[model samples]
Target chain A: MKKMNNRSDVAVKYLLISKDGNALMEIGEKSAGIEKQIKIDGYDIETIVGFPNIEKKEQIVDGIAKIIELLKNGEKIFNDDVLIEYVDMIINEKSIDEILYFTLKHIISSNLAEKTAFFILNDKLLKLRGVVYLKRDNEDIIFENRAIKSCQIDLSNRGKIADAMFFDKVVTVNYSELPGKNIERYFDKNTIIIPVYNIKGVVGVVLLEDDGTKAKDDASLRLVSRLVSLGINYSSITKQLKLSKEDVAYFKESIEVSSTLTHMGKITASVAHEIKNPLVSIGGFAKRLERYVSDERGLSYLKIIQSETTRLEQIVNDILTYSKIFNIKREKVSLYSLLMDLEEFFKDELMIKRIMVKINCPEDLIAYIDPRKFKQIFVNLIKNSIQSIENDGEITIDVERVKNGINIIIRDTGDGFPIEIIQRPFEPFVTTKEAGTGLGLSICHKIVSAHQGQIWLDNYDDGAMVKIFIPSEGEV
Target chain B: MKVKKILIVDDEPNVARLYEDYLKDYGFEVKSINNPHEATNEFYMFQPDLVLLDVNMPDKDGLTVLRELKKVSPNVPVYLLTAHDEYKRNFNALYAEEYILKSRDPKIIVNLIEKIKE
Candidate 1:
């Protein structure tokens, strides 16, 4: 593979890998010169960590001198031989961030450079968020600052730093010392700025102080970039996985809370049933006493007792109904007979209001239903229709046979249901009337549901149109 | 004509007495037993034509008592009464002639039992 040119204008030769971490081709960067294929067999990376440079044929004498000195102690040792073992040791150490820190530290220490700063892009803002700077003072290697206060390197061609990053290639901007160039201001006189690319695009820049020698330290520069890229990718993935794990925990907690709410609902239903028993006993005894009380004052007081107890009874019934433990007795009934009886039952009110009642049903339409419960469904619906008419309104009841069931439609020539509550009319305590219990539709809905049937309001502009479907067969 | 006899078994003493009072007023010989264990004994002694059994009770529930009572007198009619609709609504109440909730007005219950007598 062709290695990045150490003689590039940038402080370091940057080889851009794809931002997604796939291809090693830098996006916009042109290596200052044609790439030279790496002579891997000539220079082993391990050699620089311990022994003198042996890749330079001119340094053969120095390499030999180092070997002879080790041999004088009855050993022939070479750093190149230990390259595999040392790389494994450095990787085995966990805390990859620290590994990258020390890996870069080791590279700078070996190359004998004065300063280095690693800059990684914040993809969201398209700016450098991290500036990992290190310094070497005599024998002490100090990590002076990893945070940059004003580290906004624009990903544009405004300066050399922006140009190298935006172009997705490394450019070594040469200067005797730190220049006014945006990225150059952070480095020493001789700096090498390299581009670090993730799999898909250029992500950051890595700048190292060049030793200012006639011949640059090309061997070590080539390897440092590889180690630094690997470290950055590892840190990004770990952070994302941690955030995802927290999201999963929050999801599980909501499920637990909802389950608890369901349990509480069951308990409340049973408690309401118990309360109804005493309420019944209280109301029953009060009514039985009304017959004995003959005075006007006593009778008027008894009337209050009678009305309030009935209202309280209805609320208990609603709670029990929601709990869903009620039973029904099924019997075959003709739909025509039920409607005729309902008409007769409401004859007085219809005559007084001068409202016409129309029934459209076949004589033989019959189904097995709990007569009382089925009657309640129609009564609740018809009563609401009657109340809606301001004057001589008409109610039309239509029944037709449909698939596996009967469809009953009650259309009234009155003001249609208010648009605000039309969508969910069956919800408990939803009513337009001031004196309504607000559970009429909910009760009707419950009765239909218990019969394993569907009931809904058919849209109409002039009047309210209700549609009901009950299976002809008994589910029991 | 011989007057019909009715036996009532309930866990609550007040409720049992309440039924006894209403049944006596309906022109029937009425007996109330609060304990399920004593219910069988009362059944044999009173030899009631009708049995009004509470669905839930101490020691033995109404279902258990019904099974025991039926084993002794399989032909007699037994009605189940419950404080709530849940027990009466359950299909476990299949053996009962009728299951009624105690939450209703007492006069309705009296009228229902009178019809069962005929």
Candidate 2:
């Protein structure tokens, strides 16, 4: 048994064997040539035996046996060709794992003297992905269960083929010369090693053993290289496809949110228009009635109408302000002045309601923000806190500078938000107040989000706190 | 003495009637029409000195009627009425002589009518 590189060499050598054995030889590339020659040889051999009466019976038996042997040999050759063909198809199809499994099965069925297995290079961890036995009887079971079955070699050995993959190197283990404990039980007494390489790195190694003369061959090594290259390319393409899908999903979600915000703006404008007219009418009529009425009782009623009208006007203005998309007119805004403005604006209202308003913002605190939008945010939060109190409640506005940003917290003495609303209070049209349009916190959320800040509601043991955190101007 | 008759046009009868009653109290003879289609007939009969027109109408938009009134009596001052500030800004760009928000107090309306007389 000698290592043969080409099919022609193997066929020629087979003919030489038949002739040397003193047998009548007939070998052709086609199956018919062999069949015809075998029949002629059977008849001639029977005549030479001098059994003319039994020649027909002997010839029939001998021809049948020769034909059966030829067919069996032909079928084995066909199977090898088909296996190679299947490996080529899988490579062309770019099925990495399938090619590995098929190649392993082919190596096992070929019954080469050596025990063989495949190993993939793990670039990230710089190690071998380890022995993928293609021809084990329980290959499917081990693959599914992910446990090493019945191989005496310890896979955890640091100096094995897997470790060599880290340095993009190949290790050839000749079992007859150096029988290492790492893979002694798996291989024959004689072994030869071959390395497989791709553009990225050394991919794997082939293990072979000598029976007599049929040992390691170049054709087998070349096939291994082709399989490794296809495997790497296929894996890369699959990874790219997965990333592209994620990006598409992100883009679709962004588009949906933008459309919803646009619709919200339109609704805000319409509501503002409807509410303003009636508010004006109420305000105007109350002023007129107040001026004409002489009774104190009539005056008080007029005052109540005037106060309510003012509240309605505030709500309309807030909705209009919040619903409009923020185009930050960035400027150096003094945080202290902004807070002071809010304090002054709410001073009279808080006094009237007997709600104490406290501020703890630093005088030197400043940020680059649209002053108008910033003012609106503060006014909304403060007004919300003031409105939350039923009677004799206090509101606190605190601003503090953190390492990378500023944090503003507005807490109220009134009862905290309902548990359900606390989780999603910033969603548009979600309100607990009977008169609220539920756009207050939503607007705050949008404004803060535009500034790349965060807004959240915190429920304390005593009351509710609304906190806003905005990155420092220079930091952003 | 000839009194200047101002025509108040609005879809809401209450709003139109309120302006009419208030304008009359301020010594301006006023006629009102809630139907936008009846605006042409009322304007022709009254020959209003100034027209207070609501921009949002059921049958005709205020700007369209403003153009029609201008064609009939170009010199008669047409004040376009809007309920929103954004609309007020838009009306400022139109050819109308004045734009007043419907939310303006009745006193402001009376003041504007007196100023037009002056």
Candidate 3:
């Protein structure tokens, strides 16, 4: 509470600070008595409005980091309500990984260093998840090896980096000052390692190269320090309050899902291998036998066997490929050109089925995404529409530009999705065709999701409809 | 112009035969060998402008053979043919001229080879 005295009515303290983080709770208990009376130079005042200090520091460095992040992007955040919303959005999330991802993005874009490596401690697993970001050709690239790999570190590690990680303290060292030869490999000549900690223990560490120039100023250092500290505290506090049990349950559920997917992929790959081997013979011999068939009846029958084998091979291949890692290679792909290419490729099939195709998109519609994955999404949706349609059916594709992404609607003149599983056709092995392996939509779902897009089955009286929305630059 | 020669190394006879047949139809001289261990020997004997090396082999993994083949004929362009699609395939195919999925049509391989030859 503010100490109002018979001194001056001219000054006021807007944000009040206390020992604990729960200043709002404290204000709730004291606001009743303070609001009733106020004495300033023997003059009565009308109001003593106060907001709680949500941070403990010599100065309020709490929201400054967020303000810096916002300002760096040229965003003007002036309204206090919007500021609180931003603060709540920043501090409320339970996932430290999400926060770190954004922080790393901001740091990289800030161009503060040549290389940065982020490590988050897994208290349950006793290991460090290493994330490395390198600035290459003016683009931030996550070095693949260090991005996917985890490192085991303890206090026994000799270098200054190990000191920072193990001791839960920040350290800076030069190339020559690095302790041992083995430890020398992990770091550059000059590095600053900072450890992030909470009430429980060490939570994360970030390594930044000194670059021999660009020495960090005091304000920036304090901001980084406080941001790290806040991130660690918020994550742990949220977990303690609401997520401790659910985290374990969610982990168990994901393990079950991934393990099941792995088992299915393994079996599918093996089966694809076994079938692919003999399929080569069957397909090769059928094409070879085409020369021997003279009569029209014999030739047509041989063609059926030939095409069937090819189709079967395709199904097996699709299943195998679907089960594998969908590595995304993003680029700026023109949707118009992609559609033209797809139209050309499918021309023969469309002719065979006697189907009419129409593309309702801008002449230069473009999106930043992996073209292959994008193609996969549209192709699967097209195929899903195709299978539902009979001969002479029509397929129309419409594209619309949304706030941050593009929305595409593919509608077909076939029976709409079955009423029961219409919502879950994206699930693996959910198909209407007798020959379908059911991985088509699932693969499409995976590819779309990897591109940070959403795919869903839409209902229309005319036929089956599938809608897709992909971000302009694959940003989520 | 001398006809472009192609070397196909695969464990599966039908696959090798399929590639051999398709490339020959495209008017390129082609040889099919099953054992990967014989790739280096075949490379010297065939002296082909291009080599189609299959990743899954019995005697030696395709990458090892690729290393040995590279040591012998450093400039002979090699195209990786693999049914497996894993990123670990990244290192194996890093040095190759191109990596083609075997599950794709044999025409794609022929097209890539002809394009490279041109």
- Which numbered prediction scores highest in TM-score against the true structure? 2
**Candidate 3 chain A weakest lDDT stretch, 10 residues:** A19-28
Q: Which 10 consecutive residues of model 3 chain B have the lowest summed lDDT? A: B86-95
Using DockQ, rank the candidates from best to worst.
3, 2, 1
Give residue A245's lDDT in candidate 3 (0 to 100): 56
Interface RMSD of each: 30.5, 30.8, 15.1
lDDT of each: 0.63, 0.60, 0.64
How are the candidates ranked when ordered by lDDT, highest leading?
3, 1, 2
Candidate 2 Cα misplacement greater than 4 A, ranges = A1-323, A352-358, A389-394, A472-476, B1-3, B37-41, B71-74, B91-94
Using Cα atoms, each model's DockQ against the true complex is 0.04, 0.04, 0.06
lDDT of 3 by residue, B1-116 (tens): 23389899989888888888878878889999999888889888889888898887756788777767865676788888876565223432455677877656777876776576
Residue A366 local lDDT, model 2: 78
- Of all native A–B interface contacts, model 2 reproduces a fraction of 0.11
Candidate 2 chain A TM is: 0.40
Off by over 4 Å in 3: A1-258, A292-298, A329-368, A391-398, A401-406, A419-423, A470-476, B1-8, B17-33, B38-53, B69-118
How well does each candidate superpose onto the true structure, as a TM-score? Answer: 0.43, 0.48, 0.47
Q: Which ten residues in a row have the lowest lDDT in candidate 2 chain A?
A: A8-17
Q: Fill in the DockQ of model 2.
A: 0.04
The candidate with the higher lDDT, 2 or 3, is 3
Q: For candidate 1, what is the DockQ-based docking class?
A: incorrect
